[model samples]
Target: MSFINKMLPNVSLIWPDVWQATLETLYMTIVSAIIAGILGLALGVWLVVTDQNGITPHPVTYNILDKLVNIFRSIPFVILLTVIYPLTKAIVGTSIGNTAALVPLVVGTIPFYARQVQTALVQVDPGVIEAAQAMGASNVDIIFRVYLREGLPDLIRVSVLTLISLIGLTAMAGAVGAGGLGNLAVSIGYQRYQSDVTIVAMLIILVMVFLVQGIGDWLTRRTTHV
Candidate 1:
């Protein structure tokens, strides 16, 4: 109780800022996630479809996209941020805020999510896809209904993974003055030696990760049947 009392004042003073940072983090994560999810899913489907033995194989296209995805994914994100800073500045008109942070966040996450989507889609039953094709289903129909539907659980699982990763990336965005819990921890907590603040920020991030994991598990279970 005494410790709680001692902490209350500081908590009260910082809580609003913390909450704001959290919201900024969430905004960046969600916006980027949605964009990445859609584009990555399409890219993943393209990768699969254009592979040597796929439904519509195209060696050249597949190889190109494959190399592109690999190349982007290979770049360390810290370097990616600096590499894309000009694009970020051009797009957002400033390279140092939550909005500007979205550029690298999306670029970093898209390749990751695309690979996950490819893996998940590949795991879908080929027989099911064949059956859909036999029924004269269009390519789009087979993709959405067969590939996506069958891969829902894995997609959710990977999405949870991606979202958690984005949280960490958002923190890194703070390096460019994109304020979030990461920025708060680094700028105020670490720089000022406010251990309590750092601890609290870490705890909050941990709680958020666990919550996302729990939701992913529940969704995966719900999509599966005994």
Candidate 2:
């Protein structure tokens, strides 16, 4: 407290609120990421495997999914938040709290991350896939044991980008009463003109962002043998 107060004299009054807000931010990110990761991975793999020249090659399904991904990707997240308010409320019983915010956050991230995942899967070597096929591997087996396994390093990189992106969006969602560090920063800090609080919140967010990036980079390096 002494050190923090020395650096930012008002830290004493808001430290407790800052800590609570940090937890809310963590809660929002973790829950949102988990939901997005699962749904995005499935949609992404399906998009890749069902394309005209892909492993399963169903042109119709691929085209439909491709269009949907494109459409969702086009909608800016701030607009999407309000646009989906009814459904978000129905699902989460509110449209402005952290949990309600998850609906839009997850929906907003899914298509983007799906595209990232698809791109990563598409980077798998053609020869490796051909060899897998030559060994009579089924499409499911190829998807799991080949594309996902071989492209993991790239996938990790994309996941890091998505997670960082979500952190920013969470800050924006704070405007709608989605309580988090973002809410603390914008509502209490900025709106209330407490520059010190805003600075502290931003610094905390920066540290979190750096940690996520460093871990992702480390994991990518560890997973890559070449």
Candidate 3:
């Protein structure tokens, strides 16, 4: 179409950089997702096991972790990035690249994913959990076989949500020179007054998001029995 042709001229000029930025975005997203998935699942299991009537009640520990999750989740990503700049620099030896962007991505996502994991785990049938316990199943067995198994669909759904959120955060990270599509949009498009470039970058991001969502939904539907 005429519209696309008009955009293509501008988009072609920045295609290589956009591709690189997209790769960086994917790297940050996938790495952080793996880390958050492991840690958040552990945190969620702990939260479930320590609540008032859980298998092993420990109000103090639960309270501490709960507060910690809330505190991290409440902080805006921009502020969190600035606040953790020193740690980022120390860890990555520079605070202005794709690798350095992982710090805030992980920090911002862990609490969010943990909360999602908790909600998903909590939705598992209480009767199923009780039955597992009544059968002399160990706590570990109950958590893995009962809780996680039953919550798989919801977990996938929420993981999708978390991944999508991470994309947005990566864009914000770009503002600080993380060099992703966000940076492409801001530095090349907005700052340079190239509306066409901005639009293309946004479209690419939107396409990526929709792809993620579609895959997540398919997985959820396939895994879910009810």
Give the runs in model 3 whose Cα sits over 4 Å from its true position: 1-5
TM-scores for the candidates: 0.94, 0.97, 0.96
- The segments of candidate 1 whose C-alpha lies over 4 angstroms from its true place after superposition are none
Tell me model 3's lDDT, rounded to 2 decimals: 0.88
Clashing pairs in 1: none
* Model 1, position 130: C-alpha lDDT score: 92
- State the lDDT of candidate 2 residue by residue for 103-222, as single tens digits: 999999999999999999998997999999999999889999999999999999999999999998888887669999889888878888888989898998999899999999999999
lDDT of 1 at 18: 81
- For lDDT, candidate 2 versus 3, the one ahead is 2
In TM-score terms, candidate 2 sits at: 0.97
Query: Highest lDDT among the candidates is held by which one?
Result: 2
Greater TM-score among 1 and 2 belongs to 2
Q: Model 2, which residues run further than 4 Å from truth?
A: 1-3
